[model samples]
Target: MQLRIKPYNKNAFPLKALLIKGDSVRHWVSEIHALGLSLSEVDAYPVPGSSANTVFGCFVLLHSNKKLSDLRMHEQFQSVRDLLFIPSFSTLFPAMSEQELRKLFSSSKYFIHPETGLVELPEPIDWSELLIVPVEKCREIEKPQDAVFIPRNVDRFQIKAMPPEDALQEMEDQVFPKKKEFEDKPLNLFEKGKLLFYKLLFTGKEGKQGMFDGSDIKMPAWLSKLWPGFGGTWFDKMQEDFADLEERNKRKVDKLMEMLENDPEEALRYAIPIDPEGRGRGQIGNAALDFFTRRSNFSLFGTDGRSGSGYAVDLGDAMYDLQRQYIKTAEELKRKGDYEKAAFVYMKLLKNYVKAAETLEEGHKYNEAASIYLKHANNKTKAAQCYEKGNMTMEAIELYKELEANEKVGDLYLTINHRKEANIYFEKVATAHIDCARFLKASIVYRSKMNDPEAAQSVLLKGWRAHRDGNNCLRCYFDNIADTKELGREINAIYKNDVSEANVDNFLDVIRHEYKKKNELAENIREIAYEIIAARSQSDPSIVVTLKNFNENDKELLKDAVRFKLNNKGK
Candidate 1:
């Protein structure tokens, strides 16, 4: 039977199955919903079966909290023959074992009568009657045209079987045949004589000149019969060698004849006219240099040294003319691994101190590089970094200190195990942070590096009083408080001294959140909260109104304190 199956929107639920009933389309959506499972439903259709009968069914897409291997059909359903499990087209199926398939045929859950609390036992399903469709065949439901037919009532699903070991070997043999096996046939007299003749007259190997020189391999008589000009390779090699020798002799004779016919003055262009008395000083050396530079095609000479290249009357007056040559020379020296000389050329000739310093760094002359960076380039930061690279700690420390880089100075001192010196620099950094109202960073430095919690608290309190914006600092301080009585004192001091009519409500809200837990510490904090309410209530009558929606326990205590403080104010 042709069935029209299509992909549905429930791709998220990977475990899906079609419930087919040839009799009628029966939906157990409500029964499945009773198990509190997430399910998606699709339109009903006929299922291909063994009998020529129209089947009707809908698909139920679902995900089980249990693993796919552990999933089974709900046992409460009565019609076991109706369910047909298919792979989802939109979602990929993991491997399903035969046992998993059988378990899925078994029911998953018991149906309970919700109103009467009656349990309906599941009907058993025949495991043999269930169809085990391969996931690949089922997923073809994605293509509406090809999804029409799925074979049923088969003994086994048409899964692609792996080839047997011997079969695989036979296939491999056909694909990659073994080399020609050994065979023997005794030669007759004519064949044997012809083979011997060809071996003696025609065999040769290709020589270094790419001509066939000589070898023992026999040539076939057919090749000789096909081309009349194709003599054996040995004869060809001898002819080629003789021709080459004759060509060499002809070239030599032509060179001699041309030399005899030429003008003699042309030869003197490269010859030095020597004075027997040594009167012509530098002539021979100049002639050699001209030859050498000409052979180099003037690549070795600068423009100033090249023939017919004019220069300024005063060469020093136009220094820019020499700049390009200096740059090219420096680059050549750098490429040739002469970095020190390259640095010298950049510094003295080009006046490029940065390039000089970088070149010296490449040469690993860190001390000289650092000096050039500081004195010529005026980059003290880079100078300090260079000194540090060279392990010159003292020089780096001085430069960092001069630059007001206290953090680097401190780290440098710590590297040398000078803890006291490091702390001195760290204190400078912390003091600078405090001056800029960076109380959080200053507190961290004092607490973590200096190991002084009291100084940290003092800085946070100073910041709080000056700017009224150190809530984070205060929270950090309170989080580190381990001792209960010290916590009480700190809380009491903040409540009594830190409150103003404008900020008193804010402090109250902070205390309420900070000490919300019910414990002895919180009880003490609550009493302090009431004390602050009492003290502030005498001055600002509206403080009690702010405590209206406070924590129940603290609000009651604060209200009593406010009444007592107002009575005292009246007296």
Candidate 2:
């Protein structure tokens, strides 16, 4: 099938493409029955666990989802579990809309974009519990493909050499056994033959070789002569093999002994099991000698199911656990102020933690271990720094906030949010009036540039408030004073000092009343109002009555003073 895959911008599953044997359906099914063991190349996450990144191939499986066996489940899940974490780490995954996630989950047999960290959807047409089965299947796609299926069951595909329909027909045709069509008949019988013997075998040091030891059956001279000489003595190879086996056993024995040390009396219970739990072994190699000799008669410890498989023993975990506790004890000693012993203990612990954490990463428990290390990180600030250095921003941000480093918080916000993200952390910046002023200054500039007068006014008001709060970061005080004076002058120009004295006095009274409540240049502002309402003291009864009775906006009769002066000069 030709398939197209669209990956999530992120995800949290084992998304892989796999193709197996393609020719005979029988072989494919056989491999599938064997837990798909032949296709080891695509088990990818736990380092080639079960995922494929290439396209174009086929596979067959014996069990579908309805009949998935334990072994088959294991083969699929081992890798599936390991790579599942890859999806959670995706930044893009969370950025997807809900609709995208639904689409991705509905498909299979796709490319997982390394960049997007998404597993693509399966092809449109498919049958069987193929999705749930521990089956061997082929995923075939274009050249330069993102993923390819391994070649185990690939040769078993029924459609390998023909069109889909023809292959299907061929498959159906092959199912019906050939009946009386062939011409040959079968022959069945048994026969016995006589044995040929060898005569006279030699003896005596460097002179010759002898025949076989006492069993009764004999061979012919030609057959015996055809036997090739075995290189080196058989004893040498046997001894070497024994030595290797012994060494391995010794190591296991040592491990067993160490394990018993944790609880000697109950050691036997763990060391020996009647039914042979496969893990129950009395001895290991020389390493576990004491456990073997003293603990129980069962010499082999930790086996494939009965005896021990050395590679499978969790020595790394054990040593790590041991060292971890040791370090903890040492840390307690140190916390009690015993610097030297604590240091020693800590060193031991560090080694153990390292080992433990490596296992964690392999077991796909990386985030957990990282969480611990993140907690035990040198110090809050130091750990935060480490996380940042390690590009673990998510972790760093979380812990750093606990350190209560507002400055650091500010820095991180500035670096990442770029001011536009004031929506998230505006309060943090709002803490410092000076900072607020700075923000408002920029905001005011932006507002004015956008021709948003109301926004500009708000920003200016914030800036003014900031200045009032003793945040004189930008010398906005002087500009504010200048504006107030200019406004006062404009109001004064709108009126003149020609009103009746009564009016000036009355306006001053209003000014004085307001000044008691707010004194922001109020006294000076009162003088301007006084001038607007004033009446010049003159011995002119006619103009006084004219201005006093006229409205505040009437022209002063003496407003013609300039004209009168010009005429007098001509006279």
Candidate 3:
């Protein structure tokens, strides 16, 4: 069932229309169900004691007056429910002129491109000349069971005759109020219904006077019959009866919840036989248990007749309520400078040790926060940080050392102006890096952090000799060493006769490529590179040939090196 969805432009109309194949009956039913969910957005608000927050996905049937089900009466609500918000998050209505339908749902899906005239309708549709049929007859085309079955013809639909202009506008405004540029508008049907439904359904005031009271908004007769708030006639009486039943159920569930919290064995025993009132206490208790365990799928908007499910405990909503109260209490305590009480609420009640610690820290109770972090949160790093923040230098150092965070310990010692202690830990960090074969890291820490070039040189040379396969130490050694004579001697000793031809070639290539600038280090390295290349040429003549080829490619840079190589070609 390929359902082609066509969305109406807000300027023309604000509804989406789906054109589907005639044989796709299942998709039609599913779409209607989706639309029912959409209409429920009108009731979507944070309801007290109910955690099923609302999400909407609505659609309406056109020209069909039959109420599908008493539970699913939203289908017959299009005329009164003027504004429909679909799953696509766009507002739409059922009414549209034939021309508007043709312009949107035609064979060519293009129209005038916004800010450009690149795409448009092939020809201007003539609504007057074309044989206009009611939208009801659209199903009669090839497939009879489909909704909005548009054919290739562009002029098949004729707009359904509507109510008066002012009446329609008022209803539309009530359903989805238009926002004025500067003026504040009253809440619309969705907004009002959301708050009203939340209060009526979740606040345990089901059948109050103002409950289901939308006497101000005007709607059609059929809609008023199914709708609770519109006329307050038959549906209101039905709602009152449902409310009475629901209130009784709520009390029973509340008792069960209290029992479950205080006495688990008693709560389990409570799920027993029917009482004198003939109400199934067992069923109710089981439902509450399911809800307590967070396995309840019973939605308030459920069309199925599941009486006990609605009364089940909503743990999520209960948790949300507790959290909201915690926030309020925490804020009040903070204002009164009672941080210990606030932290207790976060730690003991909320089980949020991080938040508890944060609250203590915010109140300048850093030691208390650090203790909480260490004991409850089991966060050593945060404990160390809080200790440092509290000016507990010894405590911070101990935690950091336990965590093997030597750098942090060094930083803390420096904060206390203990240069000797700081350098000791910093050197430990450098040595640890070298032991891990992180020679470049060790050199950087020694040079940058420790401010000891000699120590940096010693580590780099150690790394180079231990891991000659790595080029980091070799590059760092040459890049830092300022003694040109010592640099040449080190280069000679490093790439000796016993070194593999590949390793010697790699060493010379590193010096030639890295030390290319016209500096004393570069010149000395290049001179040493020529000697290594000439010696390697004794075993492998291709070394000089490769250098000559490089000089041929770019004569300016490699000319001197290539000439030196050629003069000592066989040495």
lDDT of 1 by residue, 174-286 (tens): 42222221132223445435433433443333222231233322334555577666767765654454334323322332332232235211211111111223222132210
RMSD of 1: 32.4
TM-score to true structure, per model: 0.35, 0.20, 0.39
lDDT of 3: 0.51
lDDT string for model 2 (394-461, tens) is 55566667876544554554544344432234344333423545645444343333334444444544
Show model 1 residue runs off by greater than 4 Å. 1-342, 362-364, 432-438, 516-571
Top candidate by TM-score: 3
RMSD of each: 32.4, 42.0, 41.6
- Could you tell me how far off, in angstroms, the CA of residue 517 lies in candidate 1 after the best superposition? 7.9
lDDT assessment of candidate 2: 0.36
TM-score, cand. 1 vs. native: 0.35
Residue 522's lDDT in candidate 3: 59
Candidate 3 scores a C-alpha RMSD against the true structure in Å of 41.6
